[model samples]
Target chain A: MRAIWTVAIASLCAAGLATPASAQAPAQRLPSAIIMYPNILADGVFETRIEMVNLSGRTQDVKCHFLSPPTCNGTDFFIRLTPNQPISWLASRGTLGTGNFFVNAPPFNGEGSLKCFVVPDEHGIDHQNAIQGRSITFGPDGYTESIGAIGIQRLTPGEFSTTLELDGDTYAQCPDNYHFTFVASEPGDPATESELILSTCDEDLENLISKTTVVQFQIINEFEQLLSAATSVRCYDRKVLSEINSVFTRDTLGTPTGQAIVRGVQGAVIAVIVDKFVTPAGAPAVAANEPALSRGRPARIRIP
Target chain B: MSGSRLRGVAVAVALALACGTMPARAVEVDQVDWAAVLRALGIALDSWRLSPFPRMTPTPTIPVPTATPTRTHTPTRTNTPTHTATRTQTFTPTRMPTEPASGQLSFDPSTGIAPAQRLASALLIFPYVVHSGSKDTRLTLINMSNRNIGVNCFFVKDAGPVYGCLEVGFRINLTPLQPFSWFAGQGTNNPLTFTAAPPFDGVGELKCAVDPDLPDLEAHNVLQGRATVFDEDEGNTVAYGAVGFQRLSPGHFPGVVPLDGFTYDQCPERLHFQVLTRQTGSNSSIVLTPCQQDLLTQVPTSTTVQMQIVNEFEQVFSSATSFTCHSVKSFSSFSTLSRSTLGTDTAHLVLRGVHSPLIGLVIDQFQGGPDNSTHTAANDPYLEGGKPSQIIFP
Candidate 1:
């Protein structure tokens, strides 16, 4: 009887250990940083492109939501992209989320939405697979898109980045400030942990990432000059994630994590710089000395 | 003695006869001559006869015839001398006096009695009645005759129809050469007087032109007579006539009053006569009577009429009152109100009346107030009692 009793106590202990305390206590959510490039472009046919990267340790499908933030309180953000641009998609791990957006750019009426999706493989690794992704586009009609399941590469654990090449020659120049927002979500369920990422340069290997980042481009002197560059980036841990959700949900019934990018040219400075650059170039001078290297060789000299 | 004493009785007849015969004889010598005488006597007796003295015998007396013839011849010579002396004495004058010759008379048989020439005639039109208490009368005399004549004006209370023998008093003296003119005089010394009732029965006459006290014949020759009667019981008197009186109105005598200053009361209703008697005819005719209208014709109108108002002191009073008038047909009636104050507090409120382009009336009252006072009662204090409280007119 004593041996049988002891065995029963052990079984109880095993069963108790087998069941989860809070069902794995939802995975910790990572922070996100947004990078934005602001510029004044010449008029005519033009093209604009934006590449998103995931810098989180886990592969992240970054969804970009374009909006007029409170800091840019009075502006209206409306961008046009090629193929009517899908606003929401899934990015595979370790890759850039490239979009070729046209800048004929329909008129923007204020607010828009972007959503991303990431689905993990059987081994719990995030993948850019078609069956496990989801996305939708939103804005005014004809300017709104719902491109479901766009392919996106997932970022590796350490550093991730991308570049945006905007072909400005496609459309007429527009003199106004532009703002962009990017957000990332974990693979699988949208209710799972999500993060927002930010960067200044078009490549990960070139620039550093912080809690927040802002990139401003001034098209002055027919050349783009960086004016005010500032941003805010955040580092997230499991404790911080849990604390945020607990405090937010307990107080307001939801967890809200946001990233804001404020970038624009100082119009006064740009006008002065552009005027200096666009001035006509003088004629080249004739060479004072001729080289004797070859029987008929041309020499080059600098204009005084 | 008869025959020498009776022939002596004879004896002495015989003796005497003897004597006688002797003487006769002596005479007989003479007798012889006697016989011649007897012859002559006889011739004489044929021419004449002689009467006997005492003897009774006719033939016996014949002897004496011779004697008678001789006596007659002597006496005839004596009578002729006496007749011549008497004729001479009767033809001589004794008393001779010195005196001027009498004037001669001319005869113009062709002309009849000369037309009666008007001597001096005067008309006394009294009481023009310019305004109440204001009187203006006139005495106008015309010397139609060429000769100068003196005139004296008189007033008679009860002059009968014949002004002659009427008791009159002297008022004015006018020279013969000059026409008589009388205007209203100032002060209480007016020449006329006013009475309540009409038919004043006042008669005026031009008495002796020469004063009775002055006896110079030259002066008397220039004298003339005139008489007038106030007719219609009006307030005026006029003198006009020849030597006698003519009734202006039967038993109607007008009253008379003196006019010191010209009053506007006598002005026409629509028109006013601004001329003084000195400037106009003494007997001017007006189309419209003073203060009255004439339906026949319009009076000459004037915008403003100049008038003189004199006070008791003979001072002219002009600043006391102002006048305004309105027209009625050809005439106008005027109303007078007090003027703004004169310089001093002691103002002369005496003003008879004003003459405008309208009728004339007396200025009964005048009042004054301060400059700032504009209320009717305050400014025109005379109206406080309803009837003008002050009297400015005569």
Candidate 2:
């Protein structure tokens, strides 16, 4: 009788008729927020820096668009990035990893209509495949042929970095409020197939699941001072490193850290640091292989 | 000789007297004794004179009745009388009167109408009126007053029938001193014409009429009409009119039965209206009727609105600004809006912005389809549509 029951269960599984209780349950979605930091340059221009992180185990990709105040057009101050693209920088101990992207910033046009987006990566494209399970398929002759896995990192903690320069003289001439938005997503696969022990199949299955994050900051001359005195660092994912650990290893090279930090300005220099690593004591840490520290070089940005 | 003879006679008489003697002789002897007594008396008198002086005493002469009358006859003296005459008289004169001077006459000065007021009277249907098709459809203005008058006209939209219209400019003559009676249309065809009215006698009312078909000689429906009457002699009288027409056919009617031109005169200022029947459909005739009033009280001033867009990664940017302005005579209005880019992210993105004086304003409408490809999906993932924001005038 037990053997007969086992056969029945296997038949049910093979026919794609069986479903686990967990599948019917609703999935809890995570909340995300974005912060914008603006730095004023000497040439009367402005540079903006952002950091985006995933707070949930699900990985996410974020896109940002900036509009001048009076008219919020998509092309105004817009930036697109893949899952691995860094949104800001990180500082750990005495070491700092500056962001690589450069954004041109003008004075706020006075409309106060800026926005951004964040998308989840359930397939591990933003991180490595280690945190998620990998699958391998063999040919009919028994020779191993293909290997694949969901590439998204469930980043409980992550970090991103980038810089923008704003025209200070222009800002002085027209002081205005800069509005911004940040969106988050947790995409899932819609074409996922039930596994058969002897069958091999490859499918492209990804859907967009997203949320929005919003923040506002005034453009003033003393913006850098406000950023330095901030107590809690604003980020989309405060524990972004944990989410990255689910899909990629600590030593993974070129993995993008997605985090966002927003700072207000009154016309001066502003710096943002996004760190994804944590120490043994559970404190934030900078990556050990950062280029600035490894090459023993000083990183300085001058705007004239 | 007489004395000797007398002496001889006396001697003879004395001798004869002595002889005759006695009394008679005494007399003759007295004569003789007189001489001797006289001598003796003379000697005694001389002796007596020595004692004084008793001077000669003369005896009184006798009475001789002498000739008084003889002296009077000889007196015949000539007497001459002299008389002088004096005369007295008076005189008088006359006078006259004078006169005074004279002076000239004067009247009240005329002021040009405001561009807004003119536009309010001219372009009654603004953006709704198709700007194309009839290039001959220009603007016309008329002043009903005998005295020369000046005015301006304009075009506007958005604020409904009352206040949204804006001014384009004024229509002043090149020579300022010369009183302008009429203005030609802007284009060669000159669809619209403006003229001053003839002066009325003994009345304070002036009628201004605008004829759209004047130069074209084509009859058209009047779009707007206004009239002004000076209640008092020193008051103002203004009149204005606008012309437009709705056709029964969709296409141009080369030769259709023309309708009688509508006439609106002696109307008051500050009147606004919309046409009740604007379009002509199948089996339906277009008609012009007065619509509602007080739709919009005042025109809008400078103001603005804002909007935002976001991507998969939480990054943001922005743009903000205002519209353009135009003026005609006494009215001014605005159009066009603009702004700059703002955000911390530095990546390629697209944005679009727009504004319309007719429909107010709308911001940021995402176009195209959702980008779900693996490459683009890996990049951006958000969509927004419709008017993302609004701006209102203050």
Candidate 3:
């Protein structure tokens, strides 16, 4: 009876392969072979809940790297997902009961970026576009904001390598600039606060060397008035918009809503924006969104 | 003995084909016989694919562009914007470049459409979950291109005496780089006048198209938008980007647009939602809007949608729902989506519109969090399969 069931399942699998996997178009907002969450927190009163789902009909092996800033050191792990398997874990707790892989949590009071790529199979078949992911960050004020994982699909089917190129060759190139808008932070009334988290796409994980890039911020108010600010980011940085420059506030911009265009001078970076505000009913609310991406220069990631 | 041999052959063929499509490293072939069969079958399959069979399209070998990384900037220098300060010099961001550099496709040529969320186009669709009254939805529309653009937006309710197809149309003019936002209930009156109609407590969709009357512009794709829906009492908020359909051919503006790939990109056939199964303190709901809608005729679109829930163990349970114009289907009632049935806390959902291509949003809520508060998050459903659909304007 078991053998009979196995034959039946095999027949179904063979029949389903009539339609090629390449026929499926990539959804920029969908799953990719490689996905990244720019900001994950595991500090006091904060935890990041990560959810990843395999969208393909086959099993996938994933290699994940958690990189914290300052030194930009990485903690590596592996996950094995069955066909269409969905898994969720807290960044602070790691995947203890998920049955995929056992990994220790990153250091306490540390926040950084998490990147995972589908490992090519033994026959060297690349399933670079098979997973979709999202991360929800729980904050100290009892607020939670969810951001979809930024997925980068392989431009071509090639053998896996330790040196991943983000240059429209091996994978889709990282964006040159990011455009995002937010309501200005004001002191009185329903005060609003926004945080921008940025992670560099160019890194040498093998040597644990931190790559610093100067980022330029262009601010445009609702009235079309423009001002500029500059900052340096090494590996990863998360900061309140006002801290970079007070011009981000409504008192300085002279408008309630403003748009910021950020560009990295030496390398490319991916980012997520979080905005917290109070509703008319005086209840606290938080909203998060990924910035619009513009393709530009190439960046490289060297894994150990 | 022959029957047993035939069964062996069948199993070998099945495993080979399935393994061919899967990432090889993930598969563990413990038996020597299966491994040998897979290797032999893989070789045969590669040869067959390399043949000139029209149906069996092999993965084309795209030569990796050897373009030396040309962008070299000094570590201390700051990069400047390339454009001057002019109205037409507004900054527009492209998630994925539709036009590949030097004809080398950044994505696979076989995949018809690139995965994108913030699409640049003359038309934008906010598929669902816009509310009023106790709950409010704030909409932000930005003219991404340089130069002035005229905007016409239609807000349609999803439930009512008329089957909730009623619409309120409004117009606004946005300068280059200008963004306009407003609450659905409060409404805006800067040359546009309309408000959410009574019952005052319902959800709907907002469709915004570029108006070519004042600017007399061509079909230059340059509109982008985002929407945030929040509950006043619960203080829960969810935000998402709008779906954009870019016009393909160059011509004067027309009232009716056919999304036949020639005029504009077709809508997706299936939407994949990453959802948490109905567990102790979690719930998921999806809002679907049909791709084919006639706002000019005020005729509602009816579509029968097929939904499949794929559990963690790769078990699939299926269901179907039919609705007119728009529908919000909750997983609370689907026993197959329950944690007990799925045997996991999360599952993958695939929705296909039987009659029309569709677009939608997935809203998730988790209760009993740290402070005993309910947390809500909304995301755009990943899309698959492209099918032609149409939109009629007034």
Can you give the lDDT of residue B309 in candidate 1?
23
Ranking by TM-score: 3, 1, 2
Q: Work out the TM-score per prediction.
A: 0.15, 0.14, 0.76
TM score of chain A per candidate: 0.19, 0.20, 0.85
Cα lDDT, model 2, residue A199: 9
DockQ of 3: 0.17
Give the residue spans of candidate 2 off by over 4 A.
Answer: A17-304, B1-314, B317-394
lDDT winner between 2 and 3, please give it: 3
* Model 2: per-residue Cα lDDT at residue A122: 36
Q: Identify the runs in model 1 with alpha carbons over 4 angstroms from their true place.
A: A1-304, B1-35, B42-152, B158-173, B181-209, B212-214, B225-394
Model 3: per-residue lDDT, tens digit, A1-304? 5446545655554444332222111236645767888888888677788888776555678888888877688888778777666777778777554444532233334798888888867322235567778888876444777888877766544678888876543466676766677777777564677888888888788888878889899887766678899887887899888888898898998866777778889887776778776766776678886565544557788888
Model 2 chain A worst lDDT window (10 residues): A287-296
Evaluated on CA atoms against the true complex, candidate 2 attains a DockQ of 0.00
- Backbone clash count for every predicted candidate, in the order shown: 77, 116, 9
Q: Each prediction's DockQ? A: 0.00, 0.00, 0.17
Cα lDDT over the full model 1: 0.20
